[model samples]
Target: MRPGATRVGIIDYGMGNLYSVAKAVEHLGASAVVSDRAEVLAGTDRIIFPGVGAFGDCMAALEARELTDFVRVAAQTRPFLGICLGMQLLMESSEEHGAHAGLGLLPGRVLAFPPGAMRDRDGRPLKVPHMGWNELHQLVAHPLFAGIPQDAHFYFVHSFYVEPANPELLAAFADYGFPFCAAVAVDNLFALQCHPEKSGEAGLRLLGNFLAWDGGGGPACGI
Candidate 1:
């Protein structure tokens, strides 16, 4: 963390790969600190929530850390990014295991891919975790996609996906079985179902864009 560099707080609720996410922020010339303290997050210029694994487990961890309210408030007050399971935790609930409540920052549900809809072209099973790289189709313009080209490949590793209640909140979609919300952006919050840090050049560009974001919505934030 250099002097005058933007400080980006990466929430460590015992779920995310905080070190990798921290490295990504630092690679972009920003200060990335991994902590679960509300006070630390409050002082950050921006915050990122990156998680791996189950929806229920992630939410439970946040609840244990008493970060449910803190996250919701920080997201609205500054530039916020959610990655993978972190994005799904923004939904109202998850159907992964019975009915589990999330942060409810976004009005939607995290649903598993329908059993019958998990096949790729040529009628082959695409696997439950939809692993590897997939192309992202931009549905709307935002600062996050400024330098990134259209239909760029992003690394993904998830079984569940977000179904945002408001269609306008959708920023991009990708095909695992059919089109699913691969990324979402609205106001000061931005979330990605894919792992941008693992997505190579295009992914780094998106991170750089997020680092430069001024918390004023999209392109106007930087692009």
Candidate 2:
């Protein structure tokens, strides 16, 4: 991949919103290709894992495509980004379906929000899906969020969130019933629990930022 041109591989393991993510990447001036083939990723500068389904189903799809190993290896060296369910899979495991193991790229577990933590300020159930725009407070700075405003609102639609074993990996957070990790980063790995594609301008800015990030300039982790 060229230094200024970003060719992002949108890993298609049959579990993500690859089309929407591809559009987002393209809107950001990057070439997005959807595939699970390692050859497709050979010359790519960035890898995007965009998921929109169950943990077990996603894992099964990746395993069937023989892309799990490739994903692990890529995250180790290249700039990696995961969205929504894809973000959850970056953790060590998930309790969503009987202790299913995750990629373990980050030290954490993907878990559902506690009942007490599912209500709004007025004590109303905030809904399991949590689908809408919410402000993401910058917990730690990363080049991916370079020009994003503080407390920028992003679209979200999920019942579970990642609980990082190491707090230092949390990059951004949001408050619903309480504060929770909405985005995380450890080295070149980044995962966002929200949907940047549907987030309008600020979200587009994020995608652009990711394309431009070299991963060597973010603030120290766990700030």
- Best candidate, lDDT-wise? 1
Q: What is the TM-score of each candidate against the true structure?
A: 0.96, 0.94
Question: Between which residue pairs do clashes occur in model 1?
Answer: none
Candidate 1 — which residues are off by over 4 angstroms?
A: 219-223
The TM-score of candidate 2 is 0.94
Name the weakest run of 10 consecutive residues (lDDT summed) in model 1: 214-223
lDDT of 2: 0.84
**Which digits, one per residue and each the tens of the lDDT, describe model 2 over residues 107-169?**
899888888778787878877767899999988768888788899899999988899998888
Residue 120, candidate 1: C-alpha displacement in angstroms: 1.4
Per-residue alpha-carbon lDDT of candidate 1 for residues 118-152, written as tens digits (9 for 90 to 100): 88788988888889999999988788898898999
Evaluate residue 124 in candidate 1 and report its C-alpha lDDT on the 0 to 100 scale: 89
